[model samples]
Target: MKFQTIFKTAALAGLALAGTSALAHVGPDGSAHHGFLTGFLHPITGLDHLAAMLAVGVWSAMTTRRLWLAPVSFALLLLAGALLAQAGVAFPAIEPMIAASLLVVGLLLAAQVKLPDAVGAVLVGMFALFHGAAHGQELGAGVTLAGMVLSTAVLHAAGIGLGLGLKRTSAWLPRLVGAMVALMGVNMGLGLLAG
Candidate 1:
């Protein structure tokens, strides 16, 4: 089989492995988790967060002339969100907005849409705020926020790597992943509604 074929198969298998429950974001039961280590692991463990972060990276790499703008925008805005949450500011429809982020980012990746740097930054920045707010509500310490941001950066880098590498193999691979992410977002939204 060709490399592209193999990658397609692998991506499909990954989708199956991802399962429906990956959308669930469980809090740290009993004792609240603190510091960098726990924060680092937070995004990695949650599929919704992981997918959104990576999709931003992949989309930025594929579409943006200024590669760093969108990801940096996302990170900085995420921190601002967390700070907002720590200050006891509440955002309306936080969960719904997070689901929307996945949908928007996934569609952007699938379409390989190219927006102006500032536009792309603003788009991802909006998503980052909700993500940060979610994290902020759970882990309030500065060190924990640092850890989450670090992990998010790593995931974004991995996404960029995936976008670049997959483009070499076949353009469809990233798009496939994007489509899957989008589907996941829809499923999550439905689940939220059902619950």
Candidate 2:
């Protein structure tokens, strides 16, 4: 009987914590996003999206391609996904996908995996869709879209900068960062599931 109570208490506590970090969808109260500043700040406020975005940039910078393929692909596909969301298209398992993206990207960086440029682009593109859709679904106007796009680009650049800067240090630095990102992803994914 004591064990049962302990288990129940632990489970309840876990559920409560999970719910506290949820990235809830924009409700009617969020209709305040009237301009660029709001749009620019939106994605930054979401830890899940921010981590995933930064990982993409770091991975791309660390890639042999050393080109713009991954970031460009993310941008274009993100735009496409946003459009779909605006069109009222519903994607299944959106939150899970978003969380999984960070895990995948972080693991890739930690393992220092290399793939063809096109393939990498495709992988990041998939995540971009979910990320963009999260924002697009809540935004009924294009006024903020442009700002978000610009903000996304800036965030990507910052990640690239971080990756490049880390290159000057021991190889393990970026890998450590990747591991942390992956751990965060796991936390976010479990939270979403528990909630």
Candidate 3:
């Protein structure tokens, strides 16, 4: 098979895995739990979180030469942020930054602006810190932390895979995805501002 075909297949598989994993994980009765499944489902359940996470993938796929590296960096940084949060470090602007990530990533994807791989990776990584911190805040300390981190890593991989798959499609695909992301971002922004 051709490279494109391989990428498409991998992408599809990744998305399927993500969707399946998401469906399998359910939230605790009334509170957040720190566990593999909970960690994975946490981001998937939140529209704002999902939009921003997926936007990271879409923007990275469109703009960066090292597409895979962008998401990897995001995951790593997110894990670090989670650790920090677990350690009781406070970050005041995490929510705003998360919202901004969605907006900026959406705009980048919509505009089809290609950024240097290093710059794109760094930006995504920085955003991941905020995302990770949010995740960590909800999870109590213990074995659950590790499980949650692992689950988050899987979700991040799934998003990246979905983006890579879309990249192999028609040129307009990214633009369409970008528009959707931007709309989601706007919705999230409104909600955040309201709250």
What lDDT does the true structure give each of the candidates? 0.81, 0.74, 0.66
Q: Give the per-residue Cα lDDT of candidate 2 at 192.
A: 74
Kindly report the root-mean-square deviation of model 1 from the true structure over all alpha carbons.
2.6
TM-score of each: 0.88, 0.83, 0.74
Better of 1 and 3 by lDDT: 1
Q: Kindly give the stretch of ten consecutive residues in candidate 1 with the minimal lDDT sum.
A: 22-31
lDDT tens per residue, model 1, 1-195:
899778876875575345356654443232267878998998888888888999899898888888788998998898898788778787877777788888889899888889999999999999899888888777747788899899989988888887778767777878877887777677677777887
Query: What value does the lDDT take at residue 168 in candidate 3?
Result: 84
lDDT of 3 by residue, 7-86 (tens): 85565344323321222212122225755666656676765566666777767766678777777888788778878876
Better of 1 and 2 by TM-score: 1
lDDT for model 1, on a 0 to 1 scale?
Answer: 0.81
Report clashes for each candidate as comma-separated counts.
0, 0, 0
Clashing pairs in 1: none
Local distance difference test, candidate 2:
0.74
